[model samples]
Target: MPTTAAESQFDELGSLYEDVVDWPFRRDIELPAVLHSLGDLTRSDVLDFGCGAGLYTRLLAGQGARRVVGYDESEGMLREARHREAKEQRGIEYVSQLTPALAHRFDVVLSVYVLPYVASRDGLRQMCASMARMLRPGGRLLALPLHPDYDPHSDYYTAYGFRLVSESPHVEGSPVRLELRVRGVEADVTAYYWSRGALEEALHGAGFGPVFWAAPWPPGLARIEDAPTVQRAYLRRPHAAMLDCRLARAAE
Candidate 1:
């Protein structure tokens, strides 16, 4: 399968990368929004594509997905994910290679923050195609790509507990540096953004139907005590957005 140019960035990151998931924006907002968007998973089979550290993979199992597979190209991430799986004893599968049996084997494919790593427009479409091939005819894909309208200024998002720094000429595929800021967490990851049209075009070319974009929401369900002031600012300028779409059914 074709891989992203930045795939190796997480290879040696291992356990340290897990801390990024605890960033407040993800804990209170992104996590709930994604799970709510997935709806019921009572008996569904899920594929957590680019499942670094198995954060959501573990949660999917807790949410009652019958079979959860955490697939990643990074051994560093997988090591941490597998360790957690062993320690927690969730029947989740971790794999770096896609076998023939996995094709069209999932009811849902969920990706978080994976899209930004694709190095090119064609690479993005290829990534989508790979995801499509793993789904059933009418399966759903919920991905959290960099919001096409994300603030380019570094400090615009610091109040949300992270920083985004990108150079001028914010065109398609412009590389952005994401810095995670928590008391003990340290992360600086590179990401590339695509325009709305580019995202739609790629998904459609890969056999997905119309895309639905969701803005970041405050944690109304969990209400995790995040200040109203910060919530309002981040809601209005979330650096990431929910992208919900589905693969075309066979009859189409």
Candidate 2:
């Protein structure tokens, strides 16, 4: 698979990818919304794009998906995924990239926190097009990209153990770089800041329709009274947003 600068950063942080599971905001807020939006998977042939360490890939298979395949651009991450596959024998296939022959092979494509890494508008377009082509007609695409409204100036991210080392202008097409620390180890990550309008336009151009956004917190989890003051505040300002879309059906 072709490697990009963003993928290179992930490769460097390969060992820490799994640690993301412990991030409370992601574990408690973002991921639950993604899973809730998925609804059912028992009969679906699912594609887990950017399946770092095969976390969700394994979960999908365990959820009784008929078939599950994971694709990631990082060799280091794939190695970890493959190791888990070998030990667990979940019958999941891991690949560095989606092949042309796999076009329209999936009933659902799940990409979590992936698109922001795509540094250019053209790159995002190509990524969306590839995802559209991989799904059968009427297939669903569920993604969680960095929230377009995220404030780099706030201490909100600090609660999650991330600090903004530096950032480009908050203008469209610019990149926001952050430093994440866990157990005294730090990794620098970069992601492109894409406006919500641009993202929706790209999805529609790729033949997805009726796109909708879901808040980071699941239905019952956004209550301010149920959460700590900090968490309640954090819940109001999401770090990521859910994108739910479906491929257009062929005309009868």
Q: Pick the lDDT winner.
A: 1
TM-score of each: 0.92, 0.92
**Candidates' RMSD to native:** 2.6, 2.3
Error of 2 at 13 (Å): 1.8
lDDT of 1 by residue, 1-252 (tens): 678766788887767667757777777777888888887898799999999989999889999998999999988899999998899999999999877789999999999889889989989988888888899888999998988887778898777667888884258988888787767666777888788889899899989998999876754534324555556677766778888888885412
Candidate 2's residue-wise lDDT over 1-252, tens digit each? Answer: 224447877775666877887787777776676777786799999999889888889878878899999999988888889988999899999998788877899999999878888888888887888788889999999998877877667456787877643356457878778678777788888877888998998888889998899777755753668875656756776767889999985311
lDDT against the true structure, per candidate, is 0.84, 0.80
Clashes of each: 0, 0
What would you estimate as the lDDT of candidate 1? 0.84
